[model samples]
Target: MLYRRFARPLLFRLDAERAHELAVSGLSRGWRALPGVPKEDPLLAQDLMGCHFPNPVGLAAGFDKYARAVAAWPRLGFGFAEIGTVTWRPQPGNPRPRVFRLPDDRALINRLGFNNHGAGRTAGRLARHRRRGHLGRVPLGINLGKSKRTPPEEAPSDYAESLKHLWPYADYVVVNVSSPNTPGLRDLQEESELAGILDALAAVNRARAEAAGSAPLPLLVKLAPDLEPAQLDAIVDLALARDLAGLIISNTTIAREDLASPASLAAEAGGLSGGPLRERSTQMLARARRRAGDGLVLIGVGGVFTADDAWAKIAAGASLVQVYTGFVYGGPGTARRIADGLAEYVHRAGLASISAAVGTAAEGGA
Candidate 1:
C-alpha cells in the first residue's frame, strides 16, 4: 500500500532503467548490516533441491545481477534470492532506453542483454558476504549466461566458466539459455545445444561435489516462455537425463498477446514480463509438470505478482515460485505479502503445508 502510493509513483516518473539502478543501489548499501526478518509461516516452508526454503517466494534472476545485496533478501522476506544472468565476461548490454514501462498493463519490456560485472567480480562480492557470515541465511542461487561475444557452439564452456567462478558462493545455479535480447542466445535452448551445456555443467558440478565430499550442487535451467509443448517436454527430458536439480519455468515471453499498453510501447522489441505473461507461463508450468512427473522439481517464474498468481503456479506444480517484473511494480514487501496470502490458502484448503498443495490443479495431477 505504501509502496504503490509513494515509491512506485515516484519511480514510474524516472527513466525505467534509472529507477531500477536506484533500487539496486539502495539495497546494496544499508542491507548487510541489519539483522534480517525471522521466518514467517511454517505452513509456507518446504525443503526442495536440498535447501529448506522458509517460504516458496524467491527473488528472480536479473534483479540483483551483481549479488551486491546478499543479506537483504531474507530480511525482505524472500525464501531465496538469485543473482546474475552474469556472464564469463562483462558487457554493456544493448544500448540505452532498453527498458520500457507500460503502466496501463502493469508490464515491462527489457532487452538489457545480461548486463553485469563478470563472474569474477560477482564472486568477489559474494565472498565478502560469506566472510561477514551473511551467506546461507536463505539459499543463494547464481544464474549464468553466455558472454555476448561467445559463439553459440561455445556456450557450454561459457556457462561452465561462470559457474566455476561463482560455485563456492551459490547453493544452487541456473543455466539461463532463455533470454531473447542476446542475439542467438535463445538458440542455445535447442535440444542438442541444451544437452551439451547441461552435460558440461553436470561434469563440473560432480567434480566439485567430489572434492567437497558432498552431493552435487543443485543446478537448474530457466526456459523461454514461448516454447512449444514438444520443446518444453524435450527440455524436461534433458534436465532429468543430466540429473539437474530442477527447471525454472520460464524466462519472459516474446509474444505480445492482448496487452492493454500502447502499441508503441507494447510493440517494443524485447521480452514481455508482468501481467500479460500470467496465463501462458502458468500453462507452460502445468504442461512441464505433466511431462516430468515426480522426477524433477519445477520452480515457476513469469508474471507472478500476487499470492493468487503464486498459488496458481504451485497448484500447477511449481515446487517454488519466483518473481521479477512484479517486484519492480509491487515493492519490497512483495515476497512477504505473497507468503502471507499463501498461508491463508494452506489453512483454508486443510493442507498441512504448501508442499501438499503442489500440483493440486494441474491437468493430470489433480
Candidate 2:
C-alpha cells in the first residue's frame, strides 16, 4: 500500500532513469536504518550451486549495475542479489531517455548499454564492503559483460578480465551474453562465440579457487529471450560440456508482441521485460531443463512480479527466479510478498520442499 500509493506515483513522476538513480542512492545510504529482513519460511529454502538460498527470489542484475546498495539486498528480503553487467572497461551507456516505463504493461525497456564504474573500481568498492563484513547475509553474484568497444572475437578475454577483478567478491559469477542494449552483445550467445568466453572464465575460476584453497566459485550465464529453438539447444549442450554452474534462463526480449502499452513506448528499441515476458521466459526455462537433464541448474528471470509468476518459473524448471522490472514495479516489499506467497503455494501443493516443485508443470519434470 505504501509503495503503490505513495512511492510509485512519485517515482513514476520522474524520468525513469532519474528515478532509478534516487532509489539506488536511498538504498545505499539508508540500509542500516531499514527494518531487518525476516527469515523466510523453511519451505522456501533451497541449497544449490553449493550455497543455501533462504528463498528462491533474487534481485536480478542490471537493477544494481554497481555494488552501491548490495548490502541492503538480503536486508530488503532478496534471497540473493546480483550486481553489474560490469565490463572490463567503463563506458557511458547509450544516451539519456534510454530507460522508459510502460505502466500499463508493468514493464521496463532499457537500452542503458551496461553502464557501470568498470570492474576495478567496483571491485574496490566491494572490497571495502568486505573489509567491513557487510558483503554477506544472502549470496552475492557478480555479473560480467563485455566492454562495448571490445572486438567480438576478444569477448572471452574481455569478460574474463572483469571476472578477475570481481570474482573474489562473488559467491557466483555470471557471464552476461544477453542484454539487447549492447550492440553485438547478444551475438556472443552463439555457441562458437560463447565457448571461448566460458573456457576463459573456467580457467580463471579454477586458478583463483586453487590460490585461495577453496572450491571454484560457481559460474552461470545469462541469455536473451529471443533465441530460436535450435540456438537454445546448442547453447544448452555447450553449457553442459563446459561444466558451467548454471544458466539465468533469460535476460529481456526485443519483441513487443501483446503489450498493453501504447505503440510509442512499445516501439522503443531495447529489451522488453515484466508481465509481457512471463510466458516466453518460462517456456524457455522448461526447454533448457529438458536439454540439460540433471546436468545443469537453471535460474529463471524475465517478467516475474508475484508469487504466482515466480512459482510458474520454478514449476517450469527454474531452481530459482530473479526480478528486475518486477522489483521496479513491486517496490521494496516485493521479496517478502513473493516469498510469503510461495510458502502458501508450497503448503497447498503438499510439497516437501520448494526444490521438489521444480519442473512439475512440464512434461517429464520433477
The candidate that wins on lDDT is 2
lDDT of each: 0.89, 0.90
Candidate 1 structure quality by residue, lDDT tens digits, 242-334: 878899988999998888887888988999899888888889999988888868889999889999999999999998999988899899889
Q: List the residue pairs that clash in candidate 1.
A: none
lDDT of 2 by residue, 225-313 (tens): 89998999999989888888899988989998988899988999988889899898888999998888757889999888999999999
**lDDT (C-alpha) at residue 360 in model 2:** 80
Best by TM-score: 2
Query: For model 1, what is the error of residue 363's alpha carbon versus the real structure, in angstroms, after optimal superposition?
Result: 1.6
Stretches of candidate 1 off by over 4 Å are: 32-35, 364-366
Q: TM-score for every candidate vs. truth?
A: 0.97, 0.98
The regions of model 2 sitting more than 4 angstroms off are 364-366
202: Cα error in model 2, Å: 1.0
After aligning candidate 1 to the native by TM-score, how far in Å is the CA of 339 from where it should be?
0.3
lDDT of 1 at 15: 96
